[model samples]
Target: MSGSGSIITVLDMFGARLPGDLAFSLSQCGSISADHPLAGEIAAALGGKAASLPYPRRQDFMWVTLAPTAEQLRCVIEDLRCWVLPSFGWESSPPIVSDGGPAGRMGALLLAQSPQGYFRWHSRPADTDHVIARLATMRAVIAQAPARLSQLRPTLEMLRRQFTLGLATGDRDMALQAIDEIDQRQLDTASNALSMSIRVAAAFGDDQAIVDHPQLDNLLSMRVPQRVIESVLLAHHAVFLADLEAAGDIKAALAAYLPLHDRLSGLAGHPADDADTGIVRMAAYDAALAEDARRLHLLADRFAGDTVVAALVASPPPIAPLPILEPAGQPAPETEAQSVEPAFGEPLQPSVAELETVRVAPVAVTAEPALPLGWSDVPALVATSAREPLAALLQHAALMPDACDPGDGDFLIELLTDSEIIADTKKRAQADQVLTTVIDAYVCEERFPRRERLGLYETVLDIWSSSRALSTDPIDGQLLLTMADALLRLNGHLEAAVATMITRWWEARPVRSRLAWLGEALELLTEQSSAQDYLGLWYAGAGLINVDHEGFSVADRYLWYRLGRRLGLDGTATDEALGVDWLPLHSADDPLLAAGFRKIAIVSLHERAAREAAAQIEDRTQAHVVLVTDHAAGEGTASAATADVILFVWGAAKHAVYRAFDKVRDRLEYVQGTGSASIVRALERRVRAAGG
Candidate 1:
C-alpha cells in the first residue's frame, strides 16, 4: 500500500488475451510474472513493454492502476487479506486516503464510519496497552478536530469503550480517568456513562465505587431507564450487605438487607408489569439477581429466628428481565447535497425568492393589556363628582362589591390617608365620613361576609404598613390593631395574605409597642387552629424580631418559646427558630418527619437562597432537592414536572419568570419566604396539608 494521494496508472495498450495457466496464477496469487503469457497483457494494461516494466509489490502502492476482474479482486481480499477498491472509471477523483497501509487505512475508515462500526471494531480483544495508546491518540485527534455532527456518536462510543476496557482489566485509574474525561467533555452522553459505570462497578463487586461515584447522585436525579436503575440499586445493596456480613457486622448487614427484602416482598405481592416480558441485556444484571437471591437464602438460614426475614425469604419477588435497547444509530449528516432533475413537462413550483415577493394580509391580533407592577397604578372606579369624592367612592364600592376592582381597595386607602385630605379640616372630615361608612358596610353581617371583611382588613393593613407612618395617635394605632384581631379571628385557614398583613402591621408598629402587641396576638390564637396556622403566625412574629440586627434577645427568645408551645413544639424547636442555625421540627408523628419524597424541585432566581433552601429541605426530609436557580434554564421544567412537590420561592421569582412551570401548576406550591427556614416550614406545612 502507498501513502495518501499516490496513484499508479495502467493502460491496456496491447489488449492481449490471457491463457488458461496464466489466468489461474493471476486468480490464485493476485499477480503475474513478466515471463508469463499474460504478463504482456498486464504490462499492456500499464502501457509498458513486458521486459521493461518493474513488478509491483503489494505494500509499495496505495492504489494500483490495473482494472482487475471481479474474481481477481475477490482473491486479493479473501486470500491476501487486503482491501481492494474497484474504481468505477473515476480514477481522477479517488476517495480521500489516510496515511497508512491497508490495516491502518481500515482503522481510519472504521473511525470515519458510523458509531456502530467503531464500537464493533474496538470491542474486540486486543493488547490492552495498545488499545490504551490508540485511545490516547484518538482523544487528541478528536480534541483537535473541528466538531462535526458526524463525530458525536463515534466520540461517545470511544469514551464508553475506554471506560469499559479500563474496568474490565482492573485498571480503576484508567476507568476513573475516563469518567473524569467524560465529565470534562460535557457531552449529552451522561446517562450512558452513568449506566456503564454502574454496571461495571457492580460486576467488579465494588459497592463503594457505585455508592461513591461522583455521578451517583446524577444517576438518581436523572430519569435513566427504570430497569437499569432498579437493577443497579439492587446490586449495589446486595454487594454492600455481603461486605457487611463478611466483616462480622451482622446487625448492620441485617439492617440493610431487611428493607430490601421487605420491598421485594411488597413488589412480589403487587407484581407490577409483566415480569416475564421484561428482559435486560446485561449478564451482570442477571448475575446480580442470582447472587442476591443466594445471599438472601444464606441470611435466612443464618437468622432463622427472625420472623420478618423468614417471612420475606419464604416468597421472593420475581426478578423481571427488561428488554435491552439496541445501540443507537448514527445521527444523520447535518447537510446533504441534493440534485433536483426537473420533469420533462412538469410546471415548476414557485421559488423561495418568488414566494417572498407575494404579500399576505397581516392578521389582526388583540393582545391582552399588561397588568400594573403595583396595585396603585391600576385604574379604579372614579367618583361621579369631585365634591364628597371619598363618600361617592365608598358608596359605589358598597353597592358593587362583586364589580369592584382590586385597585379599589388601594384607591380607598389612598383617599383615606391622603396628605391633602388629612391636612385640610374639611377634606379630613369628608374622608372620615366615607371611612366610617365603608367600615360599617364591611362589619355588617348581611352586607359584607366574614371573608369579604377579612379581605378589607388585609387591604387596610397592607396599605397602612407600606406607608411606614409614625403616627403615635392612640386612636389610629387602636383602629389598626382592632382590625388585625378581627381578621385573625375571622380567617379559619392559614392564609399567606393574613401572614403578610400581620408581618407588615408588626413592622409598621412603634418599636416599643410592637412586641407587646405581637405577644397578645399570639395569645389570642385558639388551640383549634392547625399547626400551619401557628407556624404562619410565628412567621409573622419572627419577621419583626430582627435577630440579625440585634443578637437574639431575652424577649425574642421568650416570643419564640411562646410561638413554639402554641405549635406543640419544645425548647429545641424554639432554639432552632431563634438562632441562625435552625433545624426543622421533627416528631414521630410529624407529617414531614421522614417524608420520603424522591425529589423536591425548588425554583428561585436567588441562587444562594435556593441552594440554602435545598440543603435544609434535603437534610430535614432526606429527599433529593433539585435546585433550579434560573427558571428559564433547561432543567427547570423537567425538575418541576418530575419532582413530587415544587416549592417555588414566590418572593424571589417574578410572575413572568415562573410561567414556564404552568404545565406543572398542580404540583407547585408557592413558598411565602425565601429563607431556608421559611422554605423548610413551607415544605412541612405542605406535607401536613396533603396528609403525607
Candidate 2:
C-alpha cells in the first residue's frame, strides 16, 4: 500500500486496497547519462511490461514497481538508496521527487519533522527505513544547488562588466585585472580579441618596454576590439608629438600634433550611439589635443628667429663626447699607489736640457731622398739600422691615408718601437697622434669586415708590446679601451682587448673588480655561447694582478653557472659546474665543479679554430678542386698538399685524421730506428706482405 510516514494511522481510513500498481516516481533520477545501467534497472522494477527507457526521456518522473516478495522489495529499495540518490547531489541540476501528491513532493520537510522519524515508517514494510533515510539525504542536495548557482553568477557577471568598462574608459589596470579573472575562470570562451588589445596598450605606455617590443604592428593586425583600435591610432600620434617636444624640436612637434588634433576632431563628429559614452570621451580627448597643439605652435613661434633652431634644421646633431665611467667597483679616486708611472721605462725626473729639447709638436724634416723601402722592408730595416728605419717609416706614414691598411699598420709599429723616435718626445707625440687618427678611422668605417678589423687591433697591440716604454699615454690608453668597448658592442672580437690589457696595460690598469669586468664581458655574448670561454682568459689576466682575485671566489663560480643556466644548459657536471650556489664560497673547492668549469672554457678556442677553417675554405674561388686535410696545423706535409687550402678538420664527421697518422708514424719510426738492416728489410717485407 502507498503510505506517507507522517499519517500512518490515517492511511487505512482513506481505503486500503491490494497493491495493483506498486510504483513511485523520482524526478531527480533524470541527471544520469543515457547509457548508465541504473536506467534499465528502474524500468524493470516498475513492471515486466514496462519498456526500456533512456535517461531524462522517462527518468525525469521515473516510476518503478515494487515486487511481491519482501526480498525483491528490499532489492528495489537498496538500488535507490545506494545509486540514484547520491547522483543527484553531484549533478549540476537540482532534484525533486514527482507524480506523488504535492504533500509527497515536500518529502524532505515531512522527514525532518522529527530527526529520528525513520521509526515512523517501520510499520509499513520490510526495510522501509533504508528508503526513507536515502530520500531525506537527496532532498538536502537539491536545496543547496540553487544557493551555489546564485553565488557564482554575480562574480562572473562582475568580471565581464569590468572588462567592458575598462575598454570603454581606456583603463589599462582595470582591463588587465578583468583579463586575468576571465582567464582564471575560463570565461573568455569565444574570443580573446579585447584581452590582446589591452596588453598592447599597457606595453606601449611604458617607454623602456616599448623600445624592444617588435610586435606592435603584429598586435594591431590581430582581431582586436574596434574601440581599442581607435584609441591606439590616436595614441600613436600623441606619442610622436611628445617625443619631438622632448627633443626641443618645436617645428617637428607642431607638425606631429596638428594632424593628431585633426584626427581627434574628426572622431568627435561621428558619435558612436546615443547610449554610447564614446562621444563624451572624444570631446575630452579633443580638448586635450587642442591644448597640446596650441602649446607646440606657441613654442614654434617663440623660437622662430633663434639661431640654434636654424642650425639644427640644417644639419644633424654633432657627436657627443665619450663619457668616462669610473673604473668598475672603485668608489675612491686613484691614490699614490694606483697612479701611473713615467713613460719610456724611465724615472719621473726629467733634466732641464731634456725638457727644453723635447718638442711636443712635429718638426720639419729636410728631404734626404734615400732608396724607398716597401711596407715589408720596414721590419727588415728595423733589424739593421733602427734609428734610420723608424724615421723612414714615420716619413712614409705621413704620406699614407688616415685609415691605414695592414701595410701602413706594419710601418706604424716600427715607428712606435724605434728608440730614437721615442727618445725625441715631439716625434713620439706625433706618432701617438697618428696612432689616434688610425684608431678613429677604424671606428668610423661602418663597412669594415670583422676579420680585417680584428687583424688591425692585433697588429697595433703587437707593435705597442714591442716598445721598451710599454706605458701607454693616458689619452691613448683611454682611446684603446673605448675602441675595445665599441668593437665588443658590435660583436667583434674583444679577446684582442683582453690580450692587450693583460700584456701591455696590466701594470697601471685601473680595472678594480674582476666581477665588474665580467659583467661587461657578458653583454658581448648576445649571439653565441662560445664567448663564455673568454671569461677564463679574463680571469687569468685578473689573477696576475692578485693572489686571490674575484675569479677564485664561489660567487664567481655561481656567476659562471648562472650564465650557463641562461643559455639553457642542463645541470650536468660538464655543463653547469654543479649548479648555482646562492652562498659564496671562500674558494672553489669542489674538484668535479672545477673540471667542468675548465671544460666550459675550451668552447671559445674551438669555435675560433672552426671559424678560421671555414674562412679558409671560402677564400678559394679560382681553384678547380679543393682538398682539406685534418693533418694541417699550418705546418708539415699537410700544408704542402697540392690543394686549394688546408683545413685542420673536414668532412661530415669532422675527423682529425692527423692524430691517428701521428700515432702510426710514432710506432713506425720506433721500429725503423731499433731494427738492424736485415730486420728492417724483413719488416718492410712483412709490411708489403700485409698491404698486398
Candidate 3:
C-alpha cells in the first residue's frame, strides 16, 4: 500500500497481463544480472532494458528495487519459495529449507504479515531470574485489574442515581447519600454535582436541600468528614434555629440537633470540632428547658392562678410544728424573727444568730400582796407574773357598774405605771389607750356601742408583742411583758392561755422559718370557736402583711382573702377588717358626680378601697367611676389620661399606688383621708366650686 497524506493511493496491476511469465531462483545477493530468469520481465514491466533492475541491499534471501520510473517507484522483498514460478506440470511437494533461508544474528527482527494483522513480538537478552520476575509481576496486575473495576461498577451506578434524584427533587438526604457514595467510590464528577446542588439549596434556604434540611444536623455524628459541606450546613442550621426562635417555638428551637451557633463561631474564631460542639448543644438544650420549667413553676406558685391545691401541697401551711419552749436555764435554739412574726417583718427582724438570748419560764408566784377590790388572788394568774395581779385589777375596773367610773379608769392607769416591763413609750401609750377605751366603754354607755373591746385587745397585744419580739428598731423588750399582762386582762382566761403560749413562742425557735405564727394562731382561734369577725380581721391583717408588703415574696394575699371570706363578715364588718372607713361616706353619691361629672377616677392603694369607692360613685352619679390601684397599672394610665375628675386619695396609700397617678394631677378635684367626712367634704367642695 502506498499513501499520500492520510489518503491511500492504490495501483492494482497484479492480475494484469504481463509481457511474459518469468521464473527465478531466489538468493541473497547484491546484484541482479541480465541472466536472471525474471530480469527481462521486470525490465519489460518497467518498460526498460534488463540492466535497469536495481540491487538495493543483500537480504536473508533476496531484496529488489525497481529503478525510479517517471510515474512511480517501489521496493519489495520476494519469497521466491512462495512466489508462483513458471514450472513443469505435475510435481507438488513441500520444500525443505537447507539453512532456514539465511540465518543471521539473533538481533535481527523477524517481521511477519498475516491476514489478521501485522504482529511484532520483541525479546531482549536477560538473565533467567530477571525475566521470570518481570513475567510474574505482569501476571499479578492482569489478574486483579478486572476484578477491581467490576467491584466498583455497582457503587458508581448508585452514586449516579443518587445524584440524578437529588437534582430532580430537592431531596437533601438523597443528595447527601450520593455525595457519600461518590466519596467512597472516588467518583469525583458525581461528588461535585451533588455538592453544587447542596450549595444551591443552602443559598436559597431550600427545605429539602442537604445544607438547609434539619437532617443535616446528623453530620455531627457522621464518621466520615464532610469538609466542603459542613460549614454550609452549620450556617443553615443557625438560620433555621433563629427562625424557630423568632416564631416562639422555644422548645423546638432549643431542641435543634446541633450547637450551630457555637460551631459557626468556632469556624470563624476558634477551632472546635463536631464532637465538642455536640456536647455543648446537648448541655444548652437541657439547661434551657430546666430554666423555663423553673420560671413557670415559680410564677404559678406566686400567682396562685388556678393552682391553689398545688400551692398548698408544695408549701404546706405552718411549715412544721413550733418547738415546745422549755423553762428557764434550759433554753431552746434561738428562733429567726422571720419565723414568729409575719413575712412582712422578715427583712426587719434580726438574723437568728443576732437575736438576744431569751429564756422561757413560768411567772414566779410569791404570796399575793394586799389585793385590790374585785382582784382576788388566782394561783395561775399570780404564778404567771406580779403584773398578772394588776391585769386582774384592770379587768374588774372595766366591768364595774358605775356611770362615771373614775375608779375603773384610774385602775388602768395604775396597771400601766405599776408594771416595770412597760418600757417602750409608744407601746405603753398604746396600751394606755386600749385600757382607757375598755374602762370608758362601761363608764359611758354612749361609747359602749362603738367599743370593739376584744378587737382592741388583740390589735394592741399584737403590736406590743411584735415590737418586743420582732422589732429591728431600737425598742425595749419589756413591752412584751406589758402586752402579755394586757392580753390577760382583756380576754380573761382565753387571753391568759394565749399569753403563756406567746411567751413560750417568743423564747423558742420555729421549725418553719418562712411561716408566720398567725397561721398557727388562726387554727387555734378557729378550733376554740372564737369570734368570726375577730378571725376575719386577723386573717385580713396577716394576709396584707405576708403578701402586699415589701418583706415577703410568697403570695398569701388571696389565701387570706379566701380564709376571711369563710368568716362570713357582713359588708360593714368586712370593711372594718380590711381597714377601710368608706362605708359611712359611701351612703350617698359624691356631690361632684351629681354636678354632671362624666368620669370619676377613685384611686386607692388597696383593692377593697377602690372597689368600695367605685360602688359609691356609681350610686351617686351618671359618671363612670374607674377604680385605680397599683395592680391596675394599665387601668390607672387609661383612666388618668381620660377621666374628667380624679379623687386622689392622700390617706393610707402605698407609694406604688401614688406613683401610678403621675398623669392625672391636673384633673384632681378632690382629696380624701381615711375618714368619712374628709371624703364627703372634698366632694361637696368640688360641687360648690362647680356651681352644682
Go through the candidates in order and give each one's C-alpha lDDT: 0.43, 0.35, 0.36
Give per-residue CA lDDT, model 2, range 119-140, as digits (tens): 1111123323343344444434
Clashes of each: 10, 1, 2
Candidate 3 lDDT over 1-692, as tens digits, reads 11121110000121121123322222223233665444443333334211111111132111122221211221111211122111211111322111133344311111010111111111222222232243334334444655434344545544544443342222335556766667776766443444444443432233234544454434332221132233343344444553464365544554453344343322211112222232233223322232322222322332333222122224322222222322234455456722553221112233434222211111111112333434223222333444554455543433222212333233343445445426655445445433433422331221121233444444434543443355322112222322333344345566545544454443443322322334324423333344553463364454344222322211122223334554665655555444342123332444554587787776555354355446545656767877665533456646565777766554323323332344454566434232222333455566777777
lDDT of each residue in 1-692, candidate 1, tens digit only: 11111112121211122123323233335455655533543433333211111122232212222212222322322321221122111121223222232355434433222111111111112232333233334334544877667534335434544454343223345556667777778754677567656755543334445656776656654444333444444444444453464365544554454434422321211111212111111112222233333323333343445443443344332344222221124242233311242221222354555344222111111111232322232122222224544334443443332223443356557765567666767555455444444443343212122554466667756564554346543333434444554555467463445455545665565353454445434543432243456576565555455332133322234435555666776666666555443322444554554567888988766565466567656655678888776634355656566898988765445433343554555677766434444456568667778778
* TM-score quality measure for candidate 3: 0.20
2 versus 3: better lDDT goes to = 3
| Alpha-carbon deviation at 166 in model 1, angstroms | 60
**Higher lDDT: candidate 1 or 3?**
1
Weakest ten-residue segment in model 2 by summed lDDT: 596-605
| lDDT of model 1, residue 103 | 56
Residue ranges of candidate 2 with Cα displaced over 4 Å: 1-408, 441-458, 461-515, 518-692
Clashing pairs in 1: 1-59, 2-61, 2-62, 11-45, 278-321, 278-322, 279-321, 279-322, 279-323, 280-322
How many clashing pairs in candidate 2? 1
Checking candidate 3 for backbone clashes, the offending pairs are: 363-384, 589-620
Error of 3 at 321 (Å): 58
